[model samples]
Target chain A: MRRQVMDWLEERTGLETAVNHFLYEDIPASAGWHQVMGSVALFCFMIQILTGLLLAFNYAPTPGEAHSSVRYIMTEVTGGKLIRGLHHWGASMMIVVVVSHMVQVFLWGAHKKPREATWLVGIVLLLLTLGFGLTGYLLPWDNRAYWGTVVTTQIAAKSPGLGAQIERLLGSENGVGVVTFARFYTMHVMLLPLLTTLIVGVHIYLVRRHGIAPAPNDTAPKKKFFPGQVFKDTVAIFIAFCVLFALSVFLQAPLGRLADPTDTTYVPRPEWYFLFLFQTLKFFEGPLEVVGAHILPGLAIGALAMAPFIDRGQLRKVTQRTTAWGIALLAGAAWAGLTIAAMRSTPPETDMHAGLVDAPEWQSLSPEELAGLGHFRKQNCHACHVLGEKGKAIGPDLTASATKRDAAWHIAHFKSPAEVVPGSSMPPLTLPERQLNALAAFMLQLKPGSGASLDSAPDAVVNGAMVYQQQQCGICHQANGFGMKVGPALNGLASRRKRDWVVKHFYEPQMMVPGSTMPPYRLPKQQLQDLTTYLMELPARAPSRD
Target chain B: MLAEDSETSRRRFHLGVIYTLMGTIGAALGIPAAGYLLVPGSSNRKEEWVEVTNLEKLKAGEPEEIVFRRNRKDGWKILSEKTSAWVTKKPDGQVIAFAPSCTHLGCAFHYDEKHKNFLCPCHTSTFDLEGKPLEGPAPRALDRYQMKIEGGKILLGAVVKSQES
Candidate 1:
């Protein structure tokens, strides 16, 4: 009965014949494990589609709710974390697989002649994969998403005369805003997928039209696709997918703090896959920026597309095609070297597990705790004590103190420092009831390895640190057994002078200390505050028995 | 002939491995996706006592509707939903609170001061001073909220449904 039904369907649709042709087609016996990359790429694409569809069910595209909705998927929805993780990691996996497939095809001289269309379409598909990443990146609407796209669109804006137009087309005419969100969402979920599907259809059709490229200079008999080639492809896909699943299980996709357009302190970095391009742009700044931002990338992609035509020689062997092989190898090495350099130079992402930067924890701080952190900085508490990686070690490290003391003790200490600890160097804070509670609340939360350091410090302090090094303040003033003794020692300077005196000294160096021929430094008031804050960190002198 | 036999055996082994690998991958994707798609039944949120109004505001034997905002964690959002409850201070210095909704149809019910009874406007469901059904289509007595008084403030907990009028 089933045979008759199949025969009826076959007669009507010719489906069985197509399936038989697809399953039993002759592949070159020379085709081995290396040739499995194309099928593995196809598998990665399928995984992306599956996970992407699942993610679409929960993701909201609106600016206000996008970040919160992603948080909901991670924390609230059932198995949503895993699903989103798979989708997130799956994107990177697809890029890796597609690029590997392209590399394999190029090196094997599989892109020559009849398969040239296949190779060109594959390039288009690679661009689509990258397009997917760029668009999908902004959908989360977090700080990273907002800032990264700002940088990326700015890069696009560096395209010579068409810069502004390209920038407007990529992002909103105004900036990254409501319109940009809508445009990115549309491209990520709808436009890119549709274009990719159509192009991939053409790509696969071309692949089948010209059967698998025979191994270079091979005369071995062809093998059936059903068992040998399919088996190898299946194994490759299985291993690739297992690795993807492991990553999805182990490493969560990053969702940074909510998008803060006002946050100018953020240093935006692109996803790792695009880091090579980003790193290249770093080298060509100012007038030559166009070379790194546009010309180089454009020329590289253009050269890649014209590769088959450039090396039109009939020989496919690597030894026979020395010049082409040399160029490809050199280009690949340069690209890889740039990517590695970028990875090493760029700051590690604010991953919770990375234990490097705890920006997310700052987001999770309670209102009172956040206010307390504010008071700590505003009070210049770091001048006397170390907390996390910031602050001087003049007093007790607050991280250890926080672990040892309770909130009550912290509150009492903040209120009357002398009363709480006899002969304590800390001045009586004498803050209001609310501020006292908040300061204590903030102090009690500090612990060793909290990952609060330079990034978390208010921008002024960070800028001050940079300015100090830039101005070479250490060249004259001796501090901590470093630099020259041309000026007064900086170690106990904070105890001897007030902040006002330091500011006055910067403008009129001889006024604070007579007969001191120090050069008066002219700088902006903000820079002066930064420099003062930087200098005010001198260790206080210990009490001497009178 | 021997080489052909060996090749056939190798193909058979490969076929076995392919099936096993495919099965493992299918389960890896399918299990999570199935869990993701099939949302479980809504579980109850942990009940917390929230301040409603001061005891001074509740007159003896009179039900005063106290409206307050309750902050609830709904997914990633903290939503402040405005909720109301019926509070009565007994002549004996005891306080009783009833949920604002009608026991029958979940409509907001109000105290009909003229009749000195709780009334559901939609169905004219009435309950007496102790929340016993006096008239109309209420299925049971009005639901009472677990109540406590702390520092002169009346605190209310999750609603407790009455079995009988």
Candidate 2:
């Protein structure tokens, strides 16, 4: 029955013969493993298209919802993480395969004579692949992607005549916002994909027309493309997919905190493929940045496009084409060398905001101290002052400021910045007295390891109460006709749980209760003890009438 | 003739094995893709009544601010988020709860005893004791959450998005 259906369909559509002609080809026996890179690239692109379409169903492109939508996909949608991971890793794989394919084609002298148009088309494909990466990078709308795009568009703006216009077009008039996101999303999901697919069709047609370039010796036997070559390509694609699957399972695609345009502390870095260009910028300072950013790169691409014409050599063997091969090898080596050097020289981005938040120093802060830190961040003080590894060095480094000056000095400086430092550009703070005091306290606590020893004074209880209020611990734990009921009431905590256990729980709550949702305080050892002491003493107070 | 028939049968078996292997691979990929598409709609948050504070803590004709934490189960992750509400007891002893967010820009608004009004620091939006906007950028009254007194405890229901604000 299936054979009859197939025969009828074939007779009506003439599909069988057309498909046969499309699939079958003749090639040199010498076309071996190196010939498989193009097929592998195509395979990765197909994977990208499939996974990308799935992701697009759930992705929101607006600035407000992009990050949250991605978060939903990762945490709430089953197998969403796997699909996103494949798409993410597949992008890098595609670039790798395409670059290697280009390099192999170049070395084989396949771009010469009859295949110049094919070589140029391949170059355009390379650029389109890069375009895919650049546009897709911003779709996540995380801090890394936002800031990386900012730097790239700024680089684009360094062009001589139409620089500013390009910047304004890439970035909206008000800067990266709804308009910018919409533009990038359209290019990433629609324009670039359509353009790439069309170009790929043309590229394949050219390859079929020219056929695979034979080895220089021309002594190998001919082979049909169906069983031998197609099998090799299939194996290469399967191996590529296996590698991508393993990577996706083990290494999750990074999703940094949501994009905050106001956050200038974030250090922007591009993906590894662009590291060579990024490192090149460091050598060319202010005025000459355009040279490294645009001119040099443009010249390199121009040279590559003109290579076939410049050489015009009939020799395809590497031994006979010493000059061309040497130049290519040197360029490749330079890029690889620069990439390694950049990787080693630049500190890891993970350490950029360390010791500020999500670090031991931040967790150890008292409630009042934390409030002061919040005020500092809200006021954008980091834009000028250097705080730990964060912030630029435009103002004094505040890491050791506490050791050099007292709280009173900080208060005075905040009230009158120009009086404290001659010709200071900092504006005088006009916060309420309580907030100013909190800010001063926070600044004074910035000394290295200053809060390590919590002195148990006669007023330790009052300070502990302030810590409780600052941390908003009452939000979960109820006490004295106050607080919420999320956790157990602490009205008589001294009688309920052991003091030792309470102190240990503060350090690591999971150690006490495996499934407890209470986050670890991660406070200093002495502060933990003080908090436990305060909890133990809660029952001493008489119950207040409602 | 018998040898020829056996050879053809062996070839048929090999072809069948290849077809099965291909089908297995396709199913392995297609199942996850289908699951990913369907799972998000099934994984939705179900509202439950959560205890905010004891009714005894509130006094007649006075508003008290209460902050709490709630756990949101999103697929495999249980995320704890801090939430706050302003609880007020009327002269007749009826309870009311207003969400802490301002109507203008969603900033957390706090009651200022000195000013005798709820104020949002972000845009200086102000609301009265009855959760009505008094002045500034607030477009309407503060949003309210459904509440009830259960077993001497104040229970807050799902937050209702105010259409007016």
Candidate 3:
């Protein structure tokens, strides 16, 4: 029944003859493990395409959402992390396999005679694979990706006359933004893939036409590809995939913190494959930067592409290609040396792990104080003012700012810097009152040796107490067994009424209690809330005093 | 005839071993890949109750701010984040806490003694004494924290992330 179906289909489509002809090629029995690299590369590419397509279904291209979307895929989506891991590791595996395949082809002198086109196409494929790595590296939109792209684009911008144009093309006129992300996304997912597939198709066709290059000894028997070569290819591919799978499981892909353009602390380094190029840039400075950044690499690639014509030896043996082999070995050694040097200069992964571990001092900060610290960093306050280990001493040290000045004073200083400190060069800040207060709260907690303190004044309550003092609520109300006997004693007010009631009473004193002598404070909503927060907590404080 | 039969059986045994090895390798690759695909789905966000401050140290009408560390395990990495909250003791001995984030654009709001209100410096949003939004662009009052008083200490629950407006 199956034979009849196959015959029927073949009669209609002529598929059986075409497939038989395509699969029945003869290869040299000497074609051994070395020939399997190409098939392994092809296997890795197929995996990349499958996993990349799955990832694209979830990835967002926009700068604002890209990182968060990747986080969602890694942490939330089903099997998303696994698919992402495969794709990530597949890229590295493809590069390794492709490089090994190229080296094999070069060493065996397979680029000789009529196979010049195949060799040239292979070089282009090598570059396109690297291009794939470069473009995909930034799609995660994390700190590492962002800064790596930044460094590369800056290198591109050093190419003399054409440098500016390249920079503008890669980075938008305003810098890396929506335009850059969209362009990279399109190239990574659409254009590069389509172009790679086309070149790969031509490459495979050429391989088929030329057949596997004969071994230099030329003594081995020729064998059919169906069982012999096919089985070997299958075995190599399965083993390669097993390695990739183990890597994906054990060494899960890293997802760094979300990209922050303003962050200056993060150290940026390119992916491992690009470390050689990145290290090359450090050697050339100022006027000669182009030599390392562009000219050298360009010349190397040119030499590789022109190898077939340049090395016109009719013999296809390793001994005959001594000059070519020497040059390849020298280039390989240089790349390995540079990559190792770059790896050593950078902080080790252990340092990054240590950074990820929480410090004990962090837990001592109140929520407001923590936010204030974030504001301090975000506002670039460290540029002038010294605070602990961070910031410069151009301005006065803020370690004791809280003891020196009250929350009200800090708020006033932030609004008008020069007014607070006569002749102060500090720029006036336009932050809202809330941020100013949070900043003040953070500053207050920065006393010397205060890191050991387990107890911290809650920022809201401190601010609330400040509000009570500033509003002179003590003039009419008594609290904690102090102040006048007029109105209700706020010390136990929270016990009798909820926070909302107190807030409403502040807004309209007559609404909650009839004919009350307490005048409406006409305070803002947040102030009322703060005052109420303070009033509500007053009872809790009273018991402690007792 | 017996010699030929033995030769054929030896070849068959070798072929069987090769095929079995290939199958075992295939399974070794396939099983883990399948497990990795299911990892994201099975993973859960870890939350823990962290100590904020001691209750005896909180004075009446005075709010004390405290920060606690929380660790989130993401695959092979543990991310430690410091979270802060405003803790206060009421006159009746009831303890209350609020997240430091303002209901507005999440700028930390602080007490303004001169204005007698909680003020967001970013947009000038004001909240009255009760943590109610009195003015500005804040959509609601400050978010409150889940609190537990135990063993002479105040422990704060996982921060209640306010829904983005």
Top of the candidates by TM-score? 1
Error of 1 at A138 (Å): 2.6
Tens-digit per-residue lDDT, A1-546, candidate 3: 999999999999999998888767888777776788998888788888978877776677888778766776776676676777888999999999999999888888888877899999999999999989988988988778888887766777777689878877786556677788888888899999999999999999999889888877787678766555666777788788878878877876777766777766678998898899889989999878889998999998998888889877676566677876887799899999999999999886432222222233433344355557656766898787645444554565454345577889888888897898899988888877777786788777666434323123344655565567567666777665555667666665766788777777777878888898888888777767766775676542122111
Instruction: Give model 2's DockQ, 2 decimals.
Output: 0.13
TM-score of chain B of each: 0.70, 0.68, 0.63
Task: Please give, as one word, the docking class of candidate 3.
Answer: incorrect
Across B39-155, the per-residue lDDT of candidate 3 in tens digits comes to: 445444334445557788988666656766555554333455667777767788888788888887788877776776678899999876567788888987778877776557676
lDDT by candidate, in order shown: 0.78, 0.75, 0.73
lDDT winner, 2 or 3: 2
Question: Sorted by DockQ, highest first, which candidate order results?
Answer: 1, 2, 3
DockQ values of all predictions: 0.27, 0.13, 0.09
Report lDDT (Cα) of residue A311, candidate 1: 69
In terms of docking quality, how is candidate 1 classified?
A: acceptable
- The prediction achieving the highest lDDT against the true structure is 1
Candidate 2 per-residue lDDT, tens place, A361-452, comes to 43334445545765776688878764543455456546434547777888898899899888998999998776777788778667532222
- Flag regions of model 1 displaced more than 4 Å: A1-18, A75-80, A216-221, A262-265, A318-321, A348-546, B1-11, B37-47, B54-66, B86-147, B151-153, B158-165
Native-contact recovery for every candidate?
0.59, 0.25, 0.20
Q: Write model 1 residue lDDT over A1-546, tens digit each, in one string.
A: 999999999999999999999989988878788889988988888888898898888877899888877877776788887888888899999988998888777877888887888999999999999999999999888788999988877777778899878877776668889888888899988899999999999998998899988866688888898877788889999999989988988988888767777765567888889989988988987899899988998898898899888868775665566676677789789889989998888776553222112233443343355457767777889887755556665555465447478889888888888898898888878667767876787776675434353227555644554455456676777554445778776756777889999999999988777888888888888888987875566333111111
